[model samples]
Each structure stands twice: as structure tokens, then as C-alpha cells.
Target: MSKSVVPVNIADKLSQFSELWSQKKVAVLNDYEVKLAKLKGEFVWHTHEDTDELFLVISGRLTIQLRDADVVLEPGELYVVPRGVEHCPVADEETAILLLEPAGTINTGDAGGPMTKAAEILN
Candidate 1:
């Protein structure tokens, strides 16, 4: 059963999953979906052609490499990668990140490769 309304504890919810580089859906608001992911090492280079992607770091460090620079994010830092921008994320160690994106936005984006996952709703 779903509650009419409640609170979302990002840190607590993030601790429920351990899969690296896979996004787990936690909730939805209007057309946006709230998700969490644990990442490690390097991820595939890709781009979202339709919508921008938002990344808010919850733990460790994540570096998003763009064509011109690498954006490093620590806990509490957030970045919004505009649609159609090519990029790759690298994590030297375990890092948890919160994502706010449009519902049905695939993790691997336009480049959809081996790491692509169909985000699953988490109870």
C-alpha cells in the first residue's frame, strides 16, 4: 500500500541497495522520478537526448567528465547535465547519488550500453 504522503529519507533509502551504477526508484512527483544509485569506477559515456539529468551526491566522490572538463562532486553537491550533452561519470570509490529526472529516463541514456538498466520502483 502507498501512503498518501510521507517523507523521503535519502540516506536511509540509499542504504537499502548495494548495486553499483544502477538506479533504484524511490518515489515520484508529477512528471519527475526520484532515484538513488551507488556508483564505482567509470561509467559509460552517454547523453540524454530528451531531458536534463540531475545528480546530487550523497556520499563519496563522483567526477563527471565532459568534453572540456571534469566536474567533481562531493557529498551535498548537485549538478544538472543539460540534455544532449555527452559525458561520462567516474567514481574512484563507492559513491551514493540521488537523481531527479523525468519518469522512464533510462540510466544509460542515448548511448545505451551494457550498463543500461530499467529503473525499478523500490518499496
Candidate 2:
């Protein structure tokens, strides 16, 4: 039998991954990965074919642009974009965010542009 321990400080776990765009994975269950991302500037417009993505602003503001709508999220705010919806993230300043999505979800989706990054998790 195997048992897992709950983390004491999510913020500390997040601090472990300081690299840009590299996610820090806190936990995984079935198909979902709980991750933390530190972001700045603009990310490529992309979409996932298999699952929706949830973005929660943890400590800074983030702006998300959908095909037709522009949403700004502040600390304690969250949004979910349905699968197959194209969207881009732009942060004028450094921001920290939490993400919930299916495992194997790509950051750039089907459109691998210049901004496409090979996903990596910080240990």
C-alpha cells in the first residue's frame, strides 16, 4: 500500500519553480494536474482539444483574451476556458497563477508557434 502526504505550504512549493513558463506541479489525480505558473509578457494563442483549463490568479493580475472577450483577473479571481477555445494570456508585469487541467494538456495546443514551449515541471 502507498500513502501520500499533503503539502504544508503551496506557496513554498510554488517558489521552488522560479523559471518562466515552467510549471510547478503540486499534485496529480487521474487526468488532472494541479500546477503553478509564473508568467510575464504575452503567451501564444492556443486551444486544447481534450479538456478545459482553469486559471486562478494567485498573487498578481492576468489578462486573458478569448476570440471575442477580454477578461482581467486579479488575485482571488479565476476563469475557465472551454476546450477548443482559442485564447491568449498577457501579463504586463510578473504574475503568479494556478492552473487545473488534464494531464498532457499542451501549453500551445495544436498551434505550436514561436512561443510554444516544451512543458516541464520544477521538482
Candidate 3:
């Protein structure tokens, strides 16, 4: 197998889409997919039973609402939601984030609704 040596610009890939809550797969590492999403408003309360979900703020702010407390993240910050933990992501304004999860992990997790979107490769 041949792999090309290339760099993926996060800003460039983010510029390719404007739809909120939609995930764009930018790269893959091992079995995990590196994804980017433009988020606004609130996301569904969900839980990935078998895998932890990583949310890395690229721009703006994100609040992960947990039953006990809220985890607030700003640009350059990240938080890992443990498996089986229900969390709802809320953004007061337009925010860009990077998500790291296993391949084929559903955006909505256990809470499947209209907000759920299958991640598509940015390329």
C-alpha cells in the first residue's frame, strides 16, 4: 500500500461545508476517524456505549452537559466523554470542533434523531 505524504488543513476542510451539526471526515488514524463539524445550538443527549468520544474545540466554545456537571471547552481545549456517559453538546454561537472516534461511530450515538448525520470524507 502506498500512502501519500500530505497535510490536511483544518481550516480549508472546514471551509468546504457550512451545514451545522454535520461531520466531515478529514483523516483516519488506525481505526479512528478524525472529523470536523460546525456546530450551533444544541445536540441530542446521547451516549456511545462502547467507545469514548473526544471533542476538541477548534474555534468558539462548547459545553458538554453531563448529569452531574457541565464541561466547558474553549478554543485549543478538548474533553473526552467516557463511554456510556450521556452528554449533550451546546454551543451558544457558531463553533468549529474536531471529533475523534472509532470508524462508523454514529454522531447521535444512542439518541438517534434528525440531527444524526453519517460522516463523509472531506476529500
Candidate 4:
């Protein structure tokens, strides 16, 4: 891991990317990674069998569509989708989010397709 004691500026880091649905790595905590992502529209319905996925809304609104319920999140709010549960995230407009999960967790989870991207570390 890159050594740095300075605090990460979320807004400054978020400004480095413009692509939607792509997760950019910001920090690492033991075996977990802290990520930032820009999301819009609805994501694929998927399940992370080995890890729980956390989504913290930074801007705009997000709706986590589960098999039987929907979790709505606004800025400064967060939700955790438990392991093995199928979920689809939706955003009506451009939304910025913080994600926390085990290292190497795929964005698309078990439903791998075109949107399965390995999170890139942001320098």
C-alpha cells in the first residue's frame, strides 16, 4: 500500500474521474478497500457471495433494489447489502458514492458481464 498519513480529500479524488459505474480505489484497510464510484442509471442485479457490499452516498440519491425490498439513500447516508443477497443499485441522476468491501471484490459480483471492472487505484 502507498504510505500516506494525510487525509484523503473525497471531493478532490472524485474530481479525477468522469466515467460512470467505475470504482476508484482511495484507501486500504487491512484486507478491505475504500473506493469511490460515480453511478447513474440502474446497475446489474448481482450477489457477492463472500462479502457484504457497503454503499455510502456522497451526492445525489441512490436506491438499492433488493429481492424483496428497496433501500433508499441520500447524501451522507449509507446501507450495507449483506453477503449473498441480490441487489441492484439505481440512480436517477449522476451520483457519487463510497464503497467498502474486501479487496478484489468485483463491482458486478456474481452477475459478471460488460460492467465487471477491476477497481483501479487512484494515485
Clashing pairs in 1: none
Model 4 lDDT tens row, 1-123: 557879999999999999999999999999999999999999999999999999999999999999999999999999999999999999999999999999999899999999999999998
**Which pairs in model 3 have colliding backbones?**
none
Question: Which candidate achieves the best lDDT against the true structure?
Answer: 4
Worst lDDT 10-window in candidate 3: 2-11
TM-score leader: 3
Question: Cα RMSD for candidate 1?
Answer: 1.6
lDDT of 3 by residue, 1-123 (tens): 988689999999998999999999999999999999999999999999999999999999999999999999999999999999999999999999999999999999999988888998899
TM-score of each: 0.94, 0.89, 0.98, 0.97
The residue ranges of model 1 lying beyond 4 angstroms of the native Cα positions read 1-3
Identify the superior model by TM-score, candidate 2 or candidate 4.
Answer: 4
The whole-model lDDT of each prediction reads: 0.90, 0.83, 0.96, 0.97
lDDT string for model 1 (13-98, tens) is: 88788888888889888999999999999999999999999999999999999998989999999999999999999999999998
Model 4, total clashes: 0
For model 2, residues 1-123, the per-residue Cα lDDT tens digits are 675775537688766776776676777778788888899988888888788999999987899999899999999999998998899998888899989988877778877876666556545
**Could you tell me how far off, in angstroms, the CA of residue 9 lies in candidate 2 after the best superposition?**
1.9
Ranking by TM-score: 3, 4, 1, 2
